[model samples]
Target: MQKQREVGNRVFVTGIGLISALGNNVAENHSSLAAGKDGITKAVHFESLYTETLPFGEVKLSNDELKALLHLENEFGYTRTCLLAVKAFEEAVNDSGLSAEELSSFDTALISASTVGGMCLTDQLYDDANMKFEGSEYLEAYGCAAHTMRLIEKYKINGFTDTINTACSSSANAIMMGARLIKAGRAKRVIVGGVDALAKYTVNGFNALKILSEFPCKPFDENRDGLNLGEAGAYLVLESEEVSVGKRKYAEIAGFGNSNDAHHPSAMSDDAVGAIISMKTAIESAGIDATKIDYINTHGTGTPNNDRVELFGISQIFEKVPPFSSTKSYTGHTLGASGAVEAIFSILSIQYSEIYPSLHIETNMEGFDAAPITEFQSDVSVNYVLSNSFGFGGNCTSLVIGRVN
Candidate 1:
């Protein structure tokens, strides 16, 4: 007995689950964002080269609580990253109107984005064998691919389970892939988003890059430093039009664009050529006015060079930029998880009929005189929001979330 049928391939997000540094689930996260609060704080897990020298958005869930969510038997070998994913995935599936069995009625896919997957577990494997060593019993399944597979089996989804590792733009790109699947009539329902747990590899990598901040991150401030790392996993349930008949829909994803600078492996081009092209393509695909956009969720990592180039790129696009904010101050840099986490935040703004501020931008960066919304505003109708994500290797992506309904 099939519960739903696939007709038109239009995709709508009926369910969302997120656990970040700010809060564990939707209610908690919404409260934190509403109060203009920040989640960046001291590192509570793992030793790091920049432990005391840097801050991060670490979730407060212990391994025991994480294990309970998955109802795993006996002791577990999963890493902190996998645990976070399990928690968020459970919430997403539970919130969606479709039950696991009902979702199995049609082609369902679980496509996720990740970077430094299962990092905490990998770190433990390399630690001193004599110091509480468990011999890495299940070390093989902790990476990105295996972690995703674990979720697919747990949920009994009979569709594709894959990982996208496009650096920071991974999950945002996941949505683009999901849209393609729907347009091609590949699946009636899909789960798309990203997950990442804080790890020594990421902290040390950022420290080596000299972009890890000790205090809170300031996106476009003149005294802005670097970003604070964080841990999170968020998911979106995308149901095709035919399957979404009775479900509440979120904002529509109108257009998306991705491009690589090809200039520097670790740095974005000074001219922001790639970013500009990506924004242009996304807006063009949406077939909307540049000035019609009401908000922007910037990939503002609070780094020096990144701010300059991003602001320059925005100014180049329109004569006047729209009200913008960076939710990173509230969630830290969730890395691969950032794109999807921020995407949900953008959609929330539309659903709640409000706008969240970019927390730490106090002053404009020197060369870029662009403005940032530092205070929360409401009743401002948001027709479209531009969410940007740019990462190492010059990878950049832009998505235009619109209210064409």
Candidate 2:
């Protein structure tokens, strides 16, 4: 049985911004997906020991190039992570046609998420902490909340603000919180999303776990071995219906659900308890039947554990699972930015009436009748999309985004 609750003021996604290995903005990423272009390759801009040995979804731009693109060439103390967030956030704010006064209004909120904040500059942080240098510009930019503070200060935002770091599910929770704030009448609008940049800290950490893929990740493949690390930043402008009237509404944030099974620190339980609850609760929260889900953007990390457990969870929730695929196959596992990155992909499905294929799948995983869509599909009646993001520590979140009508 599923639980139900009264629906409040509807939340609509009015604007979206994204920067990833695929491209620097929403249109570029969309074009890459439609053309079947793969962005995973050997790292060029990011410096790492695995740069030549392993594949990654590395953003093509360098830190200096990004700063120049954002017209912050004269600025200092901006890390790679902060630069990515600013690019996306600026795009989102501009896409929504928000005025400077509106951004600084009290009815607005900024809810961002990140797992690898300024920690991307781990070496600089260490040097600063040890006082090896007289004073590092990045001294105050080392926390998980550093990017959030940067945005708040840059935009002169004076409303509610928060930064979430719930592992891979960070941005999904950020989106959920933004919706809750609007529904509760605490804010009329919110900028919600996440950002993460490749760093030695994360690369070394995942490598230590022995889950770094040597080649491009193949989500839901029977012979899948591991996942590829990636870097990206994405944001969405969500507003209450009353506030978004006459605006270009991309999709309605119908419902969302979150759960923690606490089964493992980095892996889900064999039974997929947390994912099951998250999906079911999302469906119930949408006040729709499980069958109403037209598509699902799975948390398919292409790892041995995640692909299998996530499929099992889906099998339990829907009688006949809908068309599902993992966008991570294109962007690699983006960690914190994944949830919002894929959420925008889901919205594209609803808006364009198409489905993006999951690349590099040669053999389907056994024990499941459902297989991922391997080719670009169009002219489909896509109305509702379920975007799932399951993080380490069994933190699972699902968002149901649907057409406004």
Q: Candidates' TM-scores?
A: 0.93, 0.98
lDDT of 1 at 317: 97
Badly placed stretches (over 4 Å) of model 2 are 1-5
Give the least accurate 10-residue stretch of model 1, judged by summed lDDT. Answer: 1-10
> RMSD, model 1, all Cα superposed?
4.6
Clashes of each: 0, 0
Report the C-alpha lDDT of model 1 over 83-148, residue by residue, as the tens digit: 778777777777886686865554888889889886656556565334566556656655776668
Worst 10 residues of 2 by lDDT: 1-10
lDDT by residue (tens digit), candidate 2, 40-126: 999998888889899999998999999989999998889999999999999899999999999999999999999999999978888
On TM-score, the candidate that comes out on top is 2
Task: Give every collision pair in model 1.
Answer: none
